[model samples]
Target chain A: MRIFEYMGKELFSRFGLRVPKGRVVTTAYEAAWVATEIGSVAIKAQVLSGKRGKGGGIKFADTSAEAKKAARELLGMKIEGHTVEKLLIEEKLHIDREFYLSVTIDGGAKKPVIIASSQGGMDIEEVPENKIVKVHLDVELGIHPFIARNIVRRLGLDVGSRQGKELLNIILAAYKIFQEKDAILVEINPLVFCGEKIIAADAKVIIDSEALFRQKDIPYIEEQTEAEKLAQDLGISYVELEGDIAVMANGAGITMSTLDIIQRYGGAPADFMDVGGGTDMEATAKALEILLAKDPKVIFINIFGGITRCDDVAGAFAKVKKEHGIPVPVVIRLVGTNQEEGRRILREQGIEAYTNMDEAAAKAVELAALVPAGSL
Target chain B: MAIIVDQNTRVMVQGITGKQGSFHTRQMLAYGTKVVAGVAPGKGGSKFEDIPVYDTVRAVLQEHQVDASVIFIPAAFAKDAVLEALEAGIGTVVVITEHIPVQDEMEFIAYAQRKKAVLIGPNTFGIVSSGKCKIGIPPNQFFMPGPVGMVSRSGTLTYEIAGNLIAAGFGQSTAVGMGGDRIVGLTFIDVLKLFEADPETKAVVLIGEIGGNAEEEASVYIKEMTKPVVAYIAGKSAPPEKRMGHAGAIIRRGKGTYEGKVKALAEAGALVAEMPSEVPEMIRKLLA
Candidate 1:
């Protein structure tokens, strides 16, 4: 769950991190009012995607009129599939320098790591390795002040100076937020050095979805795509892809392997849909209906039945085919746990169920080739 | 030569009074696993399937000299259940519960490391030493005692590959589901080293997905390994940043990618199969 920038800043401020006074506005008029209230405002588009500055989604306005114009222009603009419905208007500052800092779970290390860089306000990838500092925090030891001081020193800031002391406080406070919030990532891009104080100019926070039960009162903004919403409604796992063929499986690993085989056989998967274990007829029909709604040229269903009976999947595919009077080609590979009975049911419905995954994937890809790519 | 459990290994089923716990406990018993004891907090002084039940792992340890523990507890109480097993000096703990929070996982992992215990998973199908002892919910008929040691991240994928391996005349010595969650207990490296040491295992089949650098890290270990390894990396066609049902199956920052994992395994001299069906043939050729 990603908290919006304004909410991130609000959470950061609550944790003792210094942030510029900001207000979230949904309209250009509201943005203008906030800009007038706080002179020299920065109108930052409220979108989840990064690189907002490079995308021209963020703009600086010296006057209220200019803020309103910038808001109007960015309000309806699209950045990485997210429409800018809101803007975060904040008091702009005269920054002496900018530094990037973040606390995120280093997947490789399986631990929380603090990433600090002297070069900030841009992509961390662009920064050289020598300038960036990474410190992996141990579960037993945690983030010590000395660790923060070392990172501060590596950032070329004097540990004895006032600005350095303030930066250390910010890093410690940010680490506190990372621990308290059960956050997957908490990043403050451009922790600006303005005169005597340090301010967080932009903030990003992603809370762990599994930790939501413990993290009460967090304003979690779940931005699900339409397909994702429908999949969630049906209690199925679905992820949309950029292709012309829909793929369905009983398990995540099998689904992925199905996608691999389809692509290997010169086909592209339109979406990934896993019906999960022991899915009955109604749920299977719903899953197929959801995939059909995407209007793919081909639908491939792969089920290595195991404890989940193949007859259950077969009956569901038949029921779905009959109910929708399916137009697109449906290829199913059902094996193990009553596979013969499953194939018999599919045959009764005038549908063929292959026993081998390779044969079924090949057939699906061959059928998919009959239609032009992306024609769906 | 099974790595984790065998006929001599005495096992205890934690949370054996619950629905999933009781069901899989029965399955494990039927599979000839020596399930000596059961731990259900409120269901003490009771017998589940004629096996003794205790309120806690410590009490269960008093009656039976259990060597390994299989946990079927809910995700909320899994941390305590695992710790209880470790506290009772149980060296091998297999957590079959899914959806354990990452923080709890970190704590338990650290605790397990301190105790010098082998923790399998908080979300796994559990380990099965083929035709000898089985734990957790994998369908047992798909397996047979053979020379190929299998390790995988996903449950159903393990079943599929194991079944295919059986059909292709290459039964497994032991199949370990390392769990699909982001923070699993026994990683690929841990199990790969076990397979390398087990004398009965002639070769190994590693099943991986687009997840944390476990596979990439395993590839580095595999480079140093002498035994032949065959790998099948899933999500080859999966889109970047899309969570493919598994909590750990997303690619971020050019890491944990299907292509990167496959390339790394290939570079390490492991045959990377395109699909699960192709795994058995590759493993057979390696052993041949």
Candidate 2:
């Protein structure tokens, strides 16, 4: 889950790392009041996307009036498709220099990697390899003080200097957050040197979703759509798309392959829904109900059941058609365990099911094209 | 002959009394798997379908000479269960549990490597050596002993392609699901190496999706194999930054794109199928 900048700063402060005092506000009046108290604040929009500075999501305000004006413009503004809902009003610091530091999992290496650079406040991908120092850390032996000090030294900072020691402390704190919080990524961009103190000017942290059960104390903001939230509650996976044909399958790969075949046959998918393994008739009905809410011209149900029985999926289609009355055409391809019973159940409802995925996908595309665009 | 498990391979079940564990144990036994012992912590001194249940892997080790361990423990206590098996000197461990914390997986997977053991998956459907042994949860009806070898990252897709292959008069020698997590214990290359050295396997089918560079890295090894490899990659129309059910099946930072994986596999001289249905025909022409 992606943590908001304000929450990440809160975590940073909790880990004994220095951060500019900030207050998160949702209204212009609150922003102005915070600016009056903090004096000369930087108004940063709270969104999940990066490059916020280039997108005009970050602005400076010297007075209360300027703070209100900036907050008014930033609120409800769209940056990379995320509407700014809250503003972080923080005390502005006079920075001498900026540096980049982060710790993330290297999937190929199967280990956590630490990346540090002298250049900051920009896309780390755009930075040249010569300017960045990357190190892989062993999970067995965590980041030691000497390991962090060496990373600081490689960035051309004096280990004996006060700023260097502060930078080392920040790096150690970032690693601590990465391990202690079950975080997948913990980044501090532009670790600014303000006179005598080094502080994390910006923070980004992404915690492991599977570890959320144990890390319950960390605050998380929901960034899912209503349909997505419904699917999550139902224990299914759903991704909304802009197309006329709705797709549902038993697993991720087969669902994606179903979408791929639909596009191959000249049809666009309205959404991606996976009922998952060992799904029962009730969960399948709930998944179909969520898909029908999109109002696609055609719905494609593909099942290559291993543990999931075909009869359960077909039973869902039958139950939904009988109760809610499906207005759109549904093309289903049922195979694997109990396929005969599944086909018999659908046939009793006056619906014919295909046995081949290609034929079923082509039929769905053909049916979708018969409907006029935007008619649904 | 199969690469991993066969009729003679002795297997042990962890969390054997749980719902999923007990259920698949019956299936594996019906398929003629030599399931010797089971570990269920407190349910010890009992028998799950006549297979002796012990308190721990160490207790089971004192009785039976087990070769591989299949785990169905929940994600919270999965780390301890796997460590117990590894500490008991089990060579092959297949973890079928899903939603394990990635940190826990990293620790156990690294330890498995240091012990020189083959860790199959932390979130997989397991492996089947067609008609001889069944480890995880793939339906046994679709498998038959033949010359083709299969490996996939997804479970149902493996069954989908396996059914198609059987329809086309081909059966698998072994099919391995490497799991759907971002960090898995085994990779495409590791299994491909085994199939390459196996004498009974004539051809291989590699099933991949939009994820890390596992497929792209496997392509380099495919170029050196003397046997033919037919590949199919799913999620061609998937949107970027969206986790499509699997934790690992997203395109992040402009990496692990469908086009890149397809290009690498094609360049390595493997016949890449555009759809799952096309795989059988490609294998027919190659093997014929």
> Tell me, what's the RMSD of every candidate?
2.0, 1.4
Our tally of clashes for model 1 stands at 1
TM-score of decoy 2: 0.98
Clashing pairs in 1: A245-A270
What's each prediction's TM-score?
Answer: 0.96, 0.98
Cα distance off (Å), candidate 2, residue A309: 1.2
Could you tell me which 10 consecutive residues in candidate 2 chain B have the lowest summed lDDT? Answer: B246-255
Runs of candidate 2 with Cα error greater than 4 angstroms are none
Task: Give the Cα lDDT of each candidate.
Answer: 0.87, 0.92
Candidate 2 docking DockQ: 0.82
lDDT of 2 by residue, A238-345 (tens): 989888899999888899999999999999999889988898999889889999988989999999887899999999999999999999989999988898999999
Error of 1 at A74 (Å): 0.4
Clashes of 2: 0
> Model 1 in CAPRI terms: which quality?
medium
Across A1-376, the per-residue lDDT of candidate 1 in tens digits comes to: 7888989998988998889988999999999899899999899999988767878899999898999999999999999888999899999989988899999876556678899998898878889998899998887678789999998898898999999899999999999998888888899988898899999999989887878888887976868888778887887889888888898898788888888889999988988888877677778888888888888998888998876788988888888777778888889888888889999998998887887889999999899889875565
CAPRI class of candidate 2: high
